[model samples]
Target chain A: MLKVHNLSVNYRGTEALNSVSLAIHAGELVGLIGPNGAGKSTLLKALLGLVAMHAGQVLFEERPLVHQRQRVAYVPQRSQIDWDYPVTAWNVVMMARTVRTGWLRSPNPRSRQAVEAAMQRLGVWDLRDRQIGELSGGQQQRVFLARAIAQDADLFFFDEPFNAIDKTTEAVILDLLAELKAHDKTVLVCSHEWGQALNRYDRLLLLNQRLVADGDPQQVMTLDNIQRAYGENLQPSERPAEMPFFC
Target chain B: MLDWLLEPLGYQFMRNALAVGLLVGVLCPIVGSYLIVQRMALLGDVIAHAVLPGLAIANFLRFNILLGSFVSGIFSTVLIAWIRTQTRVKVDAAMALTFSSFFSLGVLLLRVLGSRLDLMAILFGDILSVSRADVGRSLWVTLLLLLLVKLFYKELLFYTFDPAAAEAAGLPVHTIYYGMMAAITMTIIVGMQTVGVVLVIALLVGPATTAYLLVKQLHRMMLLGALLGVISSLGGMYISYYLDVPSGPAIALTSFAFFMLALLFSPRQGILTRRRPLRKP
Candidate 1:
């Protein structure tokens, strides 16, 4: 389980996240939904300790998350990665085992096995030798997902995994999340998905510079909560054709 | 061919220059591969120029110039990072500012001190005039760099490819970053002996980029780049010896010629001989 207490993040003197707090139990798949600049990605980065937090702390099972980063895995947005980087798909997945393999040493047999199994599970084993830039967009997404899986961490954080990916990759990610839940792992996915896709998560946290709502998907998708997070300009009930928010 | 190659070895200066050139050739591409991958090729130029101030100060203070060159090089990168992070100024602007100021300071210090160091030789290397001490220093750097790079290959690879993920995995990304900067600084100092500060960036970036056009892995790029760098350095030294040209410019031009060849004929990403498209794997 992960616990965040009064977390605040500031960017250039402006508060990006203010007094935000939330918790997720093990075996749960939680979707963090918010509009642009709503601190969704900032929340993930804060939890992973990738950025300096203005206030408060994040705890995973009683210890500070920053100290226990070895037990966590993060898949950053695809846009954050450079596809033109001269690395094979296999090399990208092997990177997940770098820290665990220890310094001044090559990956041991067990580490190599984990990388191989993860790549195979994600159906990218066939493209192992191919350059990452040569792969399709969906294949690139799958490669990153495989990297996260190869880490074998107890907690996983995904930033915008659904953005610009094909439906097949989406289905594969949902299936993998289900598998993680079955294994009693925790997952926090930062997503921009709406409507039926939101149903895939066990719970949803609507955020707009703060935690506006948190509960079951149907309960959190109320017009009042949507308007509070996405602004009053979107009238979901009156504009059913335009609104893809209702679960 | 054997007679011509053997004729240069009879001279002591040629022997020392050849040793220094080959050592630097192998060293530059290894460190340069990281810079090219991180898209910090310009940083190499910044560090090379910044070394001038260090060299001037070291001469004035009566110390080893290499130590001063290294400290100044690392300091320049730190200052650039600090400016970019603390202010809205972009990295390119920070680099340009740091490079010019340090170079100007070096020039002024050299003139004020009136040291025995030759500005012309420092600006445009005279490889044929190198002493045995220079060869020893170049050899020491080459060994140290090769050892460090071999020991930290995986950590550097992960950090260069995706720093955020490396940090999330508790890989000490910041330490790795500074370590890379140190390695690059050491390389520029060694390379300056053969190609001088102005042309060192060519040795650092050209061969690595040329290798990048033909290879898909970081290590392969380094291996191939080293081979190409050796060819360029040796070829340039021979040309300079035969044609009465400057060693620095000759080496730079040779490296550029190799790069042009790869740009046109690379199988994967060449303008003229593309065997496979970049997409549609």
Candidate 2:
């Protein structure tokens, strides 16, 4: 289980989140949704210790998340990666084995096999030798996903995994998440996906600078909750006179 | 052709210069390959120039020049990191502001202290006057760099390609980052004697960038870049010997020339002849 208690983050002297708390258990695929600048990504970063929090801490299985980082795999936003880096998909996947392989040594046979399996499972086995820059947006996302899969961690954190990706990559990622959930691994994904894509997650965290709602997809995706989350951006004046519902 | 090549090898000074050139030839490209791939080529230039103040002070005090240069180089690295993180300045902007200002301060201090250091040789290079001790130090530094890369190849590749992921994967990322900075500083400090301060970045960035266009993997890039470095350094030394040119500029020009040739004719990425391999001689 993962517990984030009294989580608050301040960005440039402004509180991005105020006293938000949440808990998630294993075998759960949770989606984090919020408007732009509402701290969906910030919360993930804070939990991973990639960003400093003005208050709060993250615990996994009753221990600090930092100590158990070996079992945690993070895939940053797609925009953060350098596609022109002189590396292939195979090399990207091989990076996940570095920590397990240890210092001053190459990846053992087991680790290599894991990399091969992850790429094969992701349908990127044939493209292993291709440079990342030469890959499509969908393929690039899959490559990073393949790297995460190769980590074989108990926990997975993905930020904006569906942004700008093709439908195929989206389906592949969803299937992988389902597979991970079946194996009792905890998965937290931050995305703006609504409607059908939102149904795949066991739980949805609707956030807008704070925890607006956290519950089942049917309950959390209500009109009231949707309005509360994106209410500021929902301008009633912009809608047609016949359509009364702004959400 | 063999006699012409052997002619320069008879003199001990020429031999020592060639040794220094060879060492630097192998050193710069490997280090530079990392810089180029990470889009941190300017960082290399920054450190190379940042070593100036320490070198000037070392000349003033009459101690080992590399020691002073090293101290100043480390200081600049720390300062750059600090300024970049402490302010809104981006990495490139911070480096630009740091290297230029540090270089100016070094020139000022040199003038204030009235050191007899030849700015020309230090700025360009006088590889002909390289001593045996300098050659030995360059050799050791090259060996040390090679070992560091060999030991941390996997970690470094991950970190350079995607640092956040590397950090998330529980690697000691800060240590790796600082260790790389230290290595770059040491490489520049030792490389001062062969290519001097101004043109040192040429060795650090040019060959690796050329190899980068041709190779698909990091180690292969380093390996091929090293080969190009050695050939260019050796060729530049010969050009200097026969044409009565300055060694540093000659070497830098040779490296740039090689890059131009590769850019136009490389099998994988050449603008003119890409998509087809050249016929073997």
Candidate 3:
């Protein structure tokens, strides 16, 4: 389990996140759904200690997140990566093993096996030789997913993994999430898809620069919570009927 | 043809110039490969120009200009990092700010000191007139850089490609970053004599970019770029010799020509041949 206490993030005199606290337990697939500029990505960065926007500590299983970095895999948004970078799918996946292998040392046979196994699990083994830029959007997502798996992290954080992806990628990610949950891996997925996709998450944390709602999907998707998170943007009638957002 | 080429070796100055040019040829593309991959080509230029003040001060103090250049290079990098952290200004604005101010100070110092041999050496990269000591220094720099690259290639690759993930993996990312900055500064200072500050960026960025269009990996790009760099330097030196032109501009132009050729003719990524997908029918 991971516990974040009184986390706050400020950027250039503006509050991006404020006093947000949450717990992510193992074997749980938590979906972080939020409106634009609601600190969804910032939350991920703060959790990983990649940014200094927050002052609180993030602990996993009673240990600081910093100590668990190797056990934590973060797949950033598609836009955050450079597709044009000169690397192959194999190379990207192999990077997961970089920290496992020491500096100036090549990957051992065991690490290579892990990388190949990760790529094979994601069905990207055949595209190993192709330049990452040449892969389709769905294939690109799979490559990153393979990298996270190759890292063999117990806690997985994916930022907008579904963006610009096809059905195959969505299926691959959903199956992987299910597999990870079965394996007792903690997963947090950030997404904007809220229609039918809202039902997929075991828990939903609706956010708007702060935690607006946190609980089972059916409990957190209330109209009042939606109004709080999307303020003045979603009237009662504007809410999608199938969403079951009770007034 | 061999005799014709050997004629240039007849003169010790020409031999020295050729040796220095060849060393820089191999060095620029190797370092430039990193800059191009990180999309820091502009940063390379900024650092290149930022060395001017150090060169001027060293000339004024009659101390080692190389030391002055290296110190100024580090100072500008620190200032840029400070501005980025302390204010809302990003790396681009900070670089623009530091590079302009440092270059102006160098220009002012040159004016105050009056244009002299040392000033000309930094400004125009008087490669042909390099002393024997310059050749030895360049050789040492080349050897040191190659050794470091060999030792830390994996770490540098991880850092440049995905800095956040590299840090998440706990690789002392900042120390590696600072080490890289120091290496880049050293490269520019050593190269300042071959192409001058104004056109040195071409040597740093051009060959690597050219290799990028043909290679699928960073290491390969570095290898191919270093080859292109050596070829350009040698070719430019010969052009300068036979055509009676300035060696610095000739080398820069030669490197640019290599890039243009790659742009137009690269097998996989050339503009001229986008590799028409084969039809299933």
Candidate 4:
């Protein structure tokens, strides 16, 4: 379980996240939804301690989350990755074992097996030898998904895993999330998706500089919540194309 | 052919220069591969130029010049990182500002102190004048850095590829970054003697980039880059011995020639000689 208390982040003196607090239970698939510049990615980065927080504390099971980083896995956005980097799919996935294997030593047989199994599970085993840039966009997404799977962490954070991905990758990601939930793992996904696809998550937290709504998908997807999170000036057409919003 | 190759070994200075050159060739590209991957090639140039002030100060105080330059070289990278992080200034502007400031300070110190250090020699290296001690230092440093690199290859690879993920996985990303900067700074210090500050970037970035075009993996790029570096170093020494050119420019030019060759003719990614779809069967 994860608990965030009064987290606030300021970027260049502008409030990016303001006093947002939420708790996620084990085996729950939570989707963090927000409009552009609503700090969805900023919130994830803050929780992962990748970004400095202005004022807040995040605890996993009563201890500070930063100290328990080993039990956490994060998949950053595709824009954050340099696909042209000279690494094979296998090499990218093997990064998961780097911290676990410790320093000054190569991956042991057990680590290697885990990497292989993770890649195979994501249907990227056959493409392991290919340079990551040479793989298609869908394949590239799968490679990172495999990397997250390989981490074998108790909790996982994915940033916009569905953005710009193909149907196959989306399916793979949904299945992985389901598998994690079934295994009692905690997962948080940042997404812009709305409509029936939003139902995939057990819970949704709509955010706009603060926590606007937090509950089951149906409870969080109300028009008032959408308008409050998106903005009062938002046109009907400005809503996510898949979800119709009637004023 | 044997006599032509053997003739350069007759002189002690040539032997020393060639020894230093070979060592530099083996070392620069290996360490420079990280810079290429991280897109921080200019940082190598910054450190190279930044060492001059340290050399001037050390020479003025009658200390070991190498120690002085190494300290300043590493310091320059830290300053650059600080400026980029604490403010809105971008890395390139920060590097340029730090590089020229440190270099200008070095020139001022050298002038005011009236030290015996040769500015021309530092600007454009005189490899043929190296003593046996230079060769020994180069040899030891190369081996030591190579060992360290081998020990931390996995961590370095992960950090270079994705610092955020590496950090989230509990690796000390800042320490890893500083360690990399230290390695690159050390490499520049050692290679500075063979090819002076001005041409050292050519040595650092040239062969690694050449290997990059031909290889898909970081290790392979380093291995092949080291091979190309050695060839360029030795070839430049020979050309300098025969054609009477400056060793630094000769070596840098030789490295550039190899890069051009790879650029044009690499089998996988070359502009020319890439197999067309018709030829792929």
What TM-scores do the predictions have? 0.96, 0.94, 0.95, 0.96
Docking class of 2: medium
Instruction: Output the lDDT of residue B101, model 1.
Output: 98
Listing candidates in order, what is each one's chain A TM-score? 0.96, 0.92, 0.95, 0.95
Worst 10 residues of 3 chain B by lDDT: B115-124
Q: Would you list the rank order by TM-score, best first?
A: 1, 4, 3, 2
Whole-model Cα lDDT of every candidate shown, in order: 0.91, 0.88, 0.86, 0.91
Error of 4 at B55 (Å): 1.0
lDDT of 4 at A72: 92
lDDT of 2 at B37: 83
Name the lDDT of candidate 4.
0.91
> Of the pair 2 and 4, which is ahead by DockQ?
4
Superposed on all Cα atoms, model 4 deviates from the true structure by an RMSD in Å of 2.5
TM-score of chain B of 4: 0.97
Q: Any runs in candidate 4 off by more than 4 Å, and if so which?
A: A237-247, B275-281
Worst 10 residues of 3 chain A by lDDT: A238-247
**Which should have the higher lDDT, number 1 or number 2?**
1
